[model samples]
Target chain A: MKPAHRKIEAPRVTVDIVIFTIEEAKLKTLLIKRKFDPFKNIWALPGGFVRSKEDIYAAALRELSEESGISGVYLEQLYTFGSPKRDPRGRVITIAYFALASRQKLRIRSASDAKDAGLFSVDDLPRLAFDHKEILEKALERLGNKIQYTNVLWSLLPEYFTLGDIQRVYEIIWGKKADKRNFRKKLLSLGLLKPIGKLRKGLRRRPARLYQFKTKKYVELKRFF
Target chain B: MKPAHRKIEAPRVTVDIVIFTIEEAKLKTLLIKRKFDPFKNIWALPGGFVRSKEDIYAAALRELSEESGISGVYLEQLYTFGSPKRDPRGRVITIAYFALASRQKLRIRSASDAKDAGLFSVDDLPRLAFDHKEILEKALERLGNKIQYTNVLWSLLPEYFTLGDIQRVYEIIWGKKADKRNFRKKLLSLGLLKPIGKLRKGLRRRPARLYQFKTKKYVELKRFF
Candidate 1:
């Protein structure tokens, strides 16, 4: 086959992250307002162009930290969006990633090209720039699907959490209440949750038992899911 | 965050396809020998750079047809590989896709920048160029995982096939012998298979009952898996 002699300009590659956390029993995502032209001052997912020497994952982490002051969270490459028209500034493609973090442990501070940063309930997100609305929808679908079969919910909770806390995280992300008895039975059968030998403290009613996630057990059980 | 001051060259985005099929009870993939430098004359997954106006998925389909003359298969974006050194030709990011087709229907012909094209058993593949091996490995794992819960196996078989045909395809891809009774029981329980009230033609033994995949049933049952 003959090689085509036409030269094509490469599209700019950027990393956009959808950071999910649970706040006040609601599913929330971190968003930042852009500070420059081309969607300037509009809330968008936290991300930027990847440097030539940096790996894509590193670029994602850097942008995540620069915008929201978040680091060392459970991050995974969600998808790649390249519709030629998705970005207004010429041709641009984005490698979208989704991360899970504990809301109580995070301190949000807008920095760099972000005028402001905050966690907004996913259901009540503000108008976003670019194709961010589509990206956010896809991330939510993935998060909801993943919580059913994977142990990703552990990332959104404290080290010691009650079964009720875990169930609430599932209910909010999935947008449906799961049967408490069935949910508990399935989780215990998986053997990925270990009892902490203590009950949740400072509660007016009976304290629920606390449990911790076992990463080793999760790895083994993930295949079955 | 301040806009990154360093002017960076945009990475060339391309699409790569790992096409798979079942041949003689062995799982196989279509490979093409490259005709250009930076891995010239070496077997690799069929792909090319996305055009300025084309979507990534369209680019994958275009390259698959250009190199192997195959089209209208079950295609999905498998993953994105963008390590800085993944490609020797400067900075290039590849959006890897995998397609499934029946061996009996496809007619392979090397075209575009490919010198030759052939199907090779995945168990005994030739030395691949660039990071094609890594791409192929990930695709195999995904295909294996998907077949267990999804109706992707239908893409590797003809319109009318027996239960034994389906079981063989599963065993080859999963790399294990599935108990025949248990396999049929599980598939029937899922309600994703419909008998066509016909028998295998001209077989050396008693004719086996023919069946087809029920896409609607599979879609409904997918959420349960």
Candidate 2:
């Protein structure tokens, strides 16, 4: 309510993304080496400063493309980090997003400045710059919680997958092994997937039956772990 | 990536909140009349510009206390709306929060500048200022989705409640009548609530059994609608 309140400085905004994918039975995240000062050559999440009059979503996708050389995937906003001393340059706040994709879909053509892109396992990550580590940790918690109540795991799966295929995804993301008998019973009881009447050969040489999610898009499941 | 990007005019930040409570068997929200220009004399969600070097959560609570004259309640961060044209005075982005309180617990003591505080039903609200209507709509959607899988509805109830008491709350929220037998069966099956083994002397002189949530805090249910 004071007149001096109008003179307060505004904080700069940036957009960062945490792209996660399941590859080789491991959960991996995309990282990029910074090409500018204040963290030059240091690894960080793919992001950049928001442009004048640019929509936040546009800023997020634009940064992802410019820094990671990927485009045209949905990026869901995760959280905004606005700690006063988070950035060495100035008072900077970042709107973070998370994207889930299948390893078979990405065709990373590192756009010149993004020549040093890295995919590190969540269990073992290198030091990240500018409070990006905190942002990534929050995204990981969201991922664990999201898989609990929703069928969003569909984003990281092929068109049709076997029981072992889906169970392996859970095991990888959960960072543990699941009891096969109990896992199969619980998965079937949820009734979210349907048998396609087809089989995939060569999982221990036993033709594993393929199943597909009944819903076309991501949805909340009535039952969860 | 451009040289001029460094001076892209940072957008100002603000915090807004949606406070919902069950009053007179209806879902009501707290709003305030602006004391200054721009939206002066117009009703809007109780909020204000975030002060420089201030935490977003602190700003949210400060605005709620200064404008709505209530404090100390936990506010959950819902979403950050950063559309470029969301505000008329330059570029302003708002981080919104939502809180659910029981009507019996609230004691509204309107402060000087917030004399025109209003509590209107979410179903019948006035012409909201700025993008508040959109923000309010999003909060309502979150409220509906939240009650589906979490024990958050306990915030709107007293220490002890009967099956009918909880059922009425659901009917009010869903805006429909639920079958008595089926509702009772499904609610019991969730196993979230436990009978206290004490009957209250009321309801047509028929002693109605009371119940309490097993968990002391809000929790995500394994089974949901």
Candidate 3:
């Protein structure tokens, strides 16, 4: 039975991060293979226990760095999962966060309680440890809804890319294709991107003009799809 | 010194809620005078610690109901504030939540851990206890940003209202007046509101048509200010 509402209880707190990026036109997340027991050898979000004297966000960044050797990504607090039975060890709560990393910043060096780490396409993920699968679903929903009116998707793209490149990123996350003509016209009208006056010349067909966001920082759009 | 990263520690967890409603065309939040020590005689957001076995959301709703006697309002997980020094009693971390209660459904019968309860305008609030002031500020920012692109503002207004009535709610929350012409035109273009086909008849001047949102539930707008 649960304690009375007035009775004070301290549940263990931890931080978990769902680091996301775009690769091969599919959404991918960084997962670390756990090295120790409870769920040994199972892949889970890169995270660890929040230290006694640390902020939750700082804990997320530190764990991401320690477990996967990835840092400085644009991370935001996604949600807090505090189901008392979530952890087998005891009553534990986790502060879940989501991060966006561009492909250029992708690197990994699994260590410190992590047996191995790699990016797995969100479409085909291994059985995750704890309630991480639920956490990933929430992160994906947030990412999908946000990219409609926020510039977060640009964080997964190169600094300069063709219009088609950006549209493909959106489609990959949405898991469906957008009408090419309407998407290009509507996306261009948002004025979120600016032409670089330079074109890509390596393509077999005509060189395509490159464009980049006016500001790389993720911000909400006044109007969007 | 603090224990190593692998050392498991249980930190006290609490749930705090910022209950917001619009009154007199000003954004207001429910505050309760603390009934017990640590912050007694001081007003704080309605909240309490989570029980040994309960979900965080259930804790939030239970706390709100126990103190304010308001329930069935729209509540969402805002953010978690877990700074080690936040609580004076011990190392307590709070999972904060925010709620939207319509003025009609709001009724206060302060009980449980509340000494008194009242509505205070967000623009001019009394000094709050604990880290509640900071939590309220975060809630207000989330509310401000959300209303721009979501139909949440309707939750604070009457079911049948004039176009001007809805615009005033926006202006009040935004803390500034919007261009009437553009606000009305742009708002109508969204096709969110439907005319009730009846006019309000209590005024001395011409009776204006009453309008209600097509749906009362909060929904995201495809395009908004």
The candidate that achieves the highest lDDT relative to the unseen native structure: 3
Give TM per candidate.
0.91, 0.81, 0.83
Pull out the clashing pairs in model 2: none
| Model 3, span A1-225: residue lDDT tens | 122234565678989999999887778999999998779999999887888778888898887777656666688899999987788876789999999888778777787788899999999999999999999999999998888778887878878999988889888988899999999999888878899999999879999899988987778775467
Q: What is the interface RMSD of each candidate, in Å?
A: 6.8, 6.1, 8.0
- DockQ winner between 1 and 3, please give it: 1
Candidate 3 residues B23-48, lDDT tens each? 88888999999888778989898887
lDDT of 2 by residue, B1-225 (tens): 123336577788888899888898899988888776667788788777777688777788787767556654546788888888887776787888888777765666555655488788998999888999999999999888888878788877777889998888888888989899998998899887899999999567789999988864768775455
**DockQ of predictions, in order shown:** 0.45, 0.31, 0.39
- All candidates: CA RMSD (Å): 3.7, 4.9, 4.7
lDDT by candidate, in order shown: 0.84, 0.80, 0.85
Highest TM-score: give the candidate number: 1
Those runs of model 3 whose alpha carbons end farther than 4 Å from true positions after fitting are A1-7, A158-164, A176-216, B1-6, B35-40, B158-164, B176-216
Q: Estimate the TM-score for candidate 2.
A: 0.81
Q: What TM-score does prediction 1 earn?
A: 0.91
lDDT of candidate 2 at residue B4, scale 0 to 100: 32
State the lDDT at B38 in candidate 1.
76
Q: Candidate 1 deviates by what RMSD? A: 3.7
DockQ of 1: 0.45
